[model samples]
Structures are given as structure tokens and as C-alpha cells.
Target: SQKIEQNSEALNIQEGKTATLTCNYTNYSPAYLQWYRQDPGRGPVFLLLIRENEKEKRKERLKVTFDTTLKQSLFHITASQPADSATYLCALDMGSGYSTLTFGKGTMLLVSP
Candidate 1:
């Protein structure tokens, strides 16, 4: 069976530091990986996407790395602030010929000043 997983616990960080999040999976090979940010009681907002062939990608203060061999992705936020606090999710596109995404449970981030 295919499985995607993120940290089940909340991560706490001080303001102005970098926060790193991990996403792991097993039993699946995806064409691309996406990371999203979800606020309370709202839908997720897309942050970054990395193709299986790409080793690393970056936008603004955000960065993502995908390792197809390990079936894992790492998400990073530099100069993180309290406003950056949110639940981050990782989704896998299984190339099922549909526009559907399989997501992990999400990992919450709490940035304190």
C-alpha cells in the first residue's frame, strides 16, 4: 500500500530562523511532489512543486528537495516569521490520469517571536 507521512507533531521555532520539514513515503512512485500551507479552517495554498527529475527547487525564501530514490522530500523556509506559522502538507501526484493529489496528514509549525 502507498503511504505518505509528515511529522505528526507540531514544530516550534524562533522567529527569523530557518525551519525544515520532512515528508516521507513508501510503496509509491510519484511524478512530482507538492507542498502546501493550510491555515486554520481553510483550504491549503500551494507553496512549491518539484518534479521527480529535479533535485532541488527554490522560490523566494522557500526551498524544496526531492529524492526519488529515497521516496522523500524536504521543505524549508528561511527567515521564517510568526506569520509563517501554519500546517504544511506534502502531496504526491501518482500520475493516475486525473487531477487528484494524495496528501499526508500535515505538520504544524509554530513560530514564536
Candidate 2:
């Protein structure tokens, strides 16, 4: 069975440091990997999208990587701040256009000052 997973444990980090989050999968192949941020009581906001053919993609202080060999993706936040604290989600889209995304349960990141 195909499935996606992210650490259910919350990641705690100090200000001015980097935070690393992991997403792993098994028995699944996705055309695109999408990362999103969701605040309390708010919907997820788009962060980064990495294609199956791409090794890595970066935007501003964030970076995302997709490794089909290992069937895993990593999401990173540099110089994390308290404002950056949120529930981070990883979703998969097969690029069928009409198909819905398969989303992970998301991991919580707490950046303390």
C-alpha cells in the first residue's frame, strides 16, 4: 500500500538556528511534492514544490528536496524564528490535474526565542 509519513513529534528549535523536518514514504510514487505551512485555526499556505525529476528546490529561507531513490523528502527552514512556528505539511500530487492531493498528518515546529 502507498503511504506518506512525517514525524508526529514536534520539533523544537531555538531562534537563529535552522530546523530540519523529514518526510518519508513507501510504495508510492508522486509526480510532485508540495510543502505547506498551517497556523492554528488557519489553512495551509503554500511553501515549496519539488518535482519528481528535480533533486532540490529553494526559495528564500526554505529548501525542499525529493529523492526517489530513498522515497523521501526533506524540508528545511534556515534561521528559524518563533513566527515560523507552525504545523508543516507535505502533500503529494500525481499531476493528474483532477486528482486530489495526498497529505501527511504534518509535524509541528516550535521556534523559541
Candidate 3:
């Protein structure tokens, strides 16, 4: 069986600080991993995708590091702001194409003034 878990609590922090979130998994061999940002009542928007062979990936303000050996991934948002507050989701690509994604519920991020 495969399982993924993210922090269920909302991370509250002041603006202009880096926010770090964790994703943990067990017993899954995923072909690819993705991170997405989702606002309330909206669909998730893809942020970064890292393959099994790759170690780390980055986009403008976001950085993601994947460690297959540890069965974990770390997501970082630098200089987070109130506007950056949202839920972040981590998904595993199962590679079958039919039911390809298994997503962790998400971790809510709250950046305060």
C-alpha cells in the first residue's frame, strides 16, 4: 500500500520569511512527483514537477527537493507574503495514465503581516 501525508494544520508566519513544508510517503514507487498550489474552493495549479532521477527543482519563488531514499519531499517558498497564503498539494504520478495521481490532502499556509 502507498500513503502520503502533509501537515494538516495551517502554518502561520510573518511576511518576508521562507515557509517550509513537508510531504511524507511510504511504500510507493512513483514515476514522477508534483507540487501544486491551491486556493480555497479552487483547483490546484501546478508549481513544480520532479522526476525520480532528479534531486531538486525550482521555479521563480518556489523550490522543491525530492529524496526517493527518504520517501519524502520538501517545499519551500521564499519571502512569503499574505498573497501567497494557500494550500499546497503534493501528488505522486502513478504512470498508468488512467488513475495517475495520488495526492496528499494539503498543508494550509497563512502568511500574516
Candidate 4:
């Protein structure tokens, strides 16, 4: 069985600073790593995805890195704002299809002015 872990504590940062979130896994080799943002009492919204063969991927002010060798993934948000505050989740897609997925409980991020 595979397990995913993300920091259970809230991460606080200044509005202008970059926020970094970590996701580590054990006992599984996934083809893709996906990041999502979830508001309290709501479903997660998709953020970014990185393939196992890729070192990093980015979109706008967001970036994601997948290091298969380390069994870890890093999610980054540059120029973070209060609106960016949310719980971020990391999910594993075992095959290329992304249909088979396992998710972590997620970490909370709070950006303050």
C-alpha cells in the first residue's frame, strides 16, 4: 500500500512572499503528481500537475516539482496573497490515465498582509 503525507500544520507567510508546500510518499510509484486547493467545507480545486519524468512544471505564479527519486513533490506559490489562503492537497496517479488516485489530507496555507 502507498501512503502520502503533507504537513498537517498551517503555514503562515507574508502576502508578498513565496509559499512552499511539501508532499512525501511511501510504497508507491506514481506516474503523475497533482496539486489542488481546497477551501473549508468545499471540494479541492485543481492547481498543477507534474509527470514523473519531469523535474518541474509551472503555471502563472504556481510551480510544482516531482522528484521520483526522492518520492517527494514540492508545490510553490510565488507572490502569495490572502486570497491564496487555503488547504492544499497532493494526489498520486498510479498510471498515465490519472483515474487511479490517492490523496493526502493536505496542508493549510495562510497568507497575511
lDDT of each: 0.93, 0.92, 0.90, 0.92
TM-score of each: 0.96, 0.96, 0.93, 0.95
Model 1: per-residue Cα lDDT over 1-113, one tens digit each: 67998988999999999999999999867888999999999999999989888999999999999998888999999999999999999999877768479999999999999
Tell me the spans in candidate 2 whose CA falls farther than 4 Å from its real position: none
The sequence of per-residue lDDT tens digits that candidate 4 reaches over residues 1-113 is 88999988999999999999999999866988899999989988999878888999999999998888899999999999999999999999998563677999999999999
Summarize candidate 3's per-residue lDDT along 1-113 as a digit string, tens digits: 67999987889989999999999899976778889999988999989988888889889889999999999899999999899999999999967866478899899999999
Runs off by more than 4 Å, candidate 4 = 96-98
lDDT (10s digit) by residue, model 2, range 14-108: 99999999999887679899999999999999999999999999999999989999999999999998999999999988888864788999999
Taking every candidate in turn, the Cα RMSD to the unseen true structure, in Å, is 0.9, 1.0, 1.3, 1.1
Question: Which TM-score value belongs to model 3?
Answer: 0.93
* Positional deviation of residue 92's Cα in model 2 after best superposition, in angstroms: 0.5
Error of 4 at 39 (Å): 0.8
